[model samples]
Target chain A: MSWGPLALSLQVALAATALATALGVVLAGVLARARFPGSDLLDALVTAPLVLPPTVLGYALLQVVGRESVLGRAWESLTGSSLVFSRSAAVLAATVAALPLVVRSARAAMEAVDPALLGAAATLGASPPRVFLTVTLPLSRAGVLAGVTLGFARALGEFGVTLMLAGNIPGLTQTGALAIYDAVQANRDAEALGLAAVMAAVGVAAVYVGTKLGRRRVHGA
Target chain B: MAREGGALAVRVRVAGPTAERPRVDVDVSFGVGLTAVMGPSGAGKTSLLLAIAGLVRPLAGRITLGGSVLFDGSGSWVPPHRRRMALVFQHLALFPHLTAWQNVAYGVPRRSDGRDRAREWLARTRVAHVAERLPSTLSGGEAQRVALARALAAEPGALLLDEPFSSLDGRLRLALGDELKDLVEALQIPAVLVTHHLEDAQRLAARVVELEAGRLRSERPEGA
Candidate 1:
């Protein structure tokens, strides 16, 4: 409900969505394109975050990037930034929570593209990279759009990971979801209700768009 | 892995499941003109074309076009795009996002003249009127014609078609067959077409190549 925390949440959520979408795409592309031993294991690892407890994930992030660990030390030396209570940390937690959804949608979209189309592109003298860029990517555009938006919405609404990893720093790491939580504790029902309504709207819109885009191309796709 | 060749020598070794012979090996040398390949379902006919087009990795054998070995034992392999040959898949994998003309242009090498060549090919294949339409919107016959135009637009060293007319109605198939024959003769590029319909091939190809299991007949022409 605090204006400062609410504003910060919006900014952090937007940045988190952007970073996560980009990372998710690269990750999804690899998951879709590559084949190797233990591929199933790799898939399980990617999707594990969806079902795992957010607090556990936050702890894991802290262990690895919490100022004392090697990665944390590298971040501190290079950027003079400790992730805890920082906007970047909020973004990281949000990304982890939303990554699997984006990747799964992207994978399904890429798979739905007819294999024959790729073969035909090759026959028409398109190099492998050309075929993917020209044919595969365009065909999967809708799915990618849906995936990224869903990821963004998920990240925007994440509470537990954001709270534990980034902490509830006003105007820095406190997201709208986090703002609502704090408002409830402070007994400010009005602000909490407002934030909840906004989050619900965002969640509904993202879900609607994702489903429509995916279904529009599902048949004759 | 034999590379002994006249013009085009292809040896394919691959078999689909449920196939009596999983290792259907086909060895054939084509000189010129369209060589129609006829066989029943699962006769490894499509595999032979895939091997020739450099799409399928033959279990073991060799394929050479104009004495340039595309594939051979051990380390010899050529990428399909570099093979400079066009293939018309049975499913007609037209670029759904592009207009028919754009699809044709995709086959032409990127250059200043690419557009003009694309238009010329479209006109030759008689799909110029519908060049602006996306492949998704085109009728089955129109899509096939656009595909043919795209293949010819490449000015490929050869043409390979897997069940080229399988989707067409009887009348359309016969008409396209006649038109296709004329197109191939005018270009003078050798070709291979796969089909379950013997009558269609007989009308189009000058020579008929038959495959049984994976083995090609010693020397014979059936129907086509």
Candidate 2:
């Protein structure tokens, strides 16, 4: 009924989606083209979060960025505050949860592009970045868009990681998923159901858009 | 060391075959004219072109274009885009997302007149009518011309054609081959044409070379 948690969730999801999309697309491109030693290992590492339990991922993230860790210390020094129980932590958790989906989908899409088309662009004197921008990105737009949409949906519903890293602090870090959990614990069935319905509707809409975009083929391919 | 004539010289040892192609170890050069490379399928013809273009690293070899070293087994290497060699792929890999004119314009140097130059090349290749069409909508001949136009628009130091006419009907192949001949002569740059057809080799090449099992089997002047 408060709507505050819903607003916080939207904010966290949007920020997480932006960060995840940028990192995911770049990592996907590298994985799609590079064939160096340990490349497969690197890919597996990126994909680890997808199959790993949320609690496991949360524990791993805590080890890397908990209050006593080096990154946590650095952030505290820079920002004059701890990072573990804040909105930023929530954003980070969602980003990590959302990233693998984007990376896998975008990588498959990018790998599907004709190598001959890339070769032709190079022969035309376009630099590597130019070729990626003009040819590779345009050809893979559908997949990238789909990945971003899916990432947003994932970030929106992120519960376990967010609960672990960014504790449920009302009006500060409590998102829609966290709010639903809090409502059920307090025996507020009506509030819990309302939040659940909102989350489900938004999640379904995002998935529908993502699926449509994923199925949309490039005209000439 | 620089070669005497401004020819494109290639002497490379490519690794032996895979399921798709045989080993390719070739040492060949091209002057300011068309030199057709005749070979059988799976004979590593495409590999040779790819190596020369710097798209494939050779086990041991050197490639020099005009007076510049494009590749040396000792570690000197120029990337494909920097080599200034335009290759029209066997499948005519035109950018599907771009219109015909845009594909030609892609290689044009960033200048105020780049689009105009692209239009001129389209007209020159006689695909001006399809300038706005995507590669998928164009007929085979139209797409071929568009690919050629895109290559020539780059004003490359050398031209590499991989089975340029293999997809066309016999009559269209002959006509396009003639047009290609005239274009090569007018451009006066080293041109390498890869074809399995003896007829195409005899018709367009000033000199013809044969590849078998990934090695150069013979080299002779045209009609020899």
Candidate 3:
């Protein structure tokens, strides 16, 4: 009945969602607009995380950021600690797990924007970046919000990757999902059920909000 | 202030034989007055406008506005936002999320009085009453005026209108057309009006050019 895991999960999920949303929206905008050779290949790479197994993704992450790796060495030198098995690792794991959902949703939304409207903005002497800020982003707000909501749900539920990278350190890296797992394995059925019910409720609420936002059309379009 | 001189000189070939239309080859110049472009559907009228506005890249030839070379057969090219051209799309294309004043404000240069400038443009276009409303709630004529206000607020070097009055009733069309004529005259910037209606062409333009299958077919002075 300890609330530490639940609190840690919320903290990790919020940080992960923020990181995912920033990177995902930019990547989605690039994928939606920029035309170049191998653009489709690039898109496939971004989407690969969604279809790949979490264990596979975790392994890949370990290779990139594990101790003795360049990033890990750099982090240790800079911060006096290894990055793996830390709260930051949990955040990274959740970010990667949540990214594809945001990217896919935001890309579709951006692509759906009327090209004519973009042209009109340009003709009004707004630069490309200005047009994106004033026209493109506002027009696709709902979709982006939906993606962020879904990404939060995904990030909160992340267990396999979190376990692999962050490990289940009580009151530290152990998030709600890992706590549920730990509780069940330790025969703490009441604790497990309580955490599971809360997780389920949050997940459902996030998904319901996401769906509603996704279905909303920009008024006056 | 009306621009004293510098016509938009265009001599370009746009390569396109899409499922809907043939390639466009046109050589024309627009002076400081309204020039109407008339053609049947799929005649590349929109393509020509897009090329001038720097939205479409032409395969060959050059486009010069006054002394500034916007595009050339070579690598010299200017992006759309730098072209100093304002195009009012046929569908109006007002930013749906913005109120009428904000839509116009978007085109106003960044300055301390930008909002006031936007309000002035809206009043000039007779849409000041609807300045706070989103485009969706505006009537057809109201939307058209808002679009016009947004375009003019940019203080562009040239103005382009694509079937600007197509959706309005006859009376409203005439009224808006007259207002457009006065605006273009006052600005003294080369204005290109693309329309399928001959009457509209004759009424607003000092010169009219017809296009067919993406080529300039004929040119005539208004009333000729």
List TM-score per model, in order.
0.92, 0.97, 0.97
The CAPRI classification for model 2 reads as high
| Tens-place lDDT digits, model 1, residues B70-108 | 899667989988887789999888888888888888878
Candidate 3: residue A158 Cα off by (Å) = 0.1
Give me the TM-scores of chain B across the candidates. Answer: 0.90, 0.94, 0.96
- Computed on C-alphas against the true complex, the DockQ of each candidate is 0.56, 0.87, 0.87
What tens digits encode model 2's per-residue C-alpha lDDT throughout B49-90? 999887888888899988899999999999999988899999
lDDT of 3 by residue, B26-130 (tens): 899999989999999988899999999999999889999999999999989999999889999999898999999988988776656679988999999998999
Isolated chain A TM-score, each model = 0.91, 0.97, 0.97
Task: For candidate 2, give the lDDT of residue A4.
Answer: 98
lDDT score, residue A194, model 3? 96
Q: In CAPRI terms, where does candidate 3 land?
A: high
lDDT of 3 by residue, A159-198 (tens): 9999989899998899999999999999999999999999
Model 2: residue B17 alpha-carbon error in angstroms: 3.8
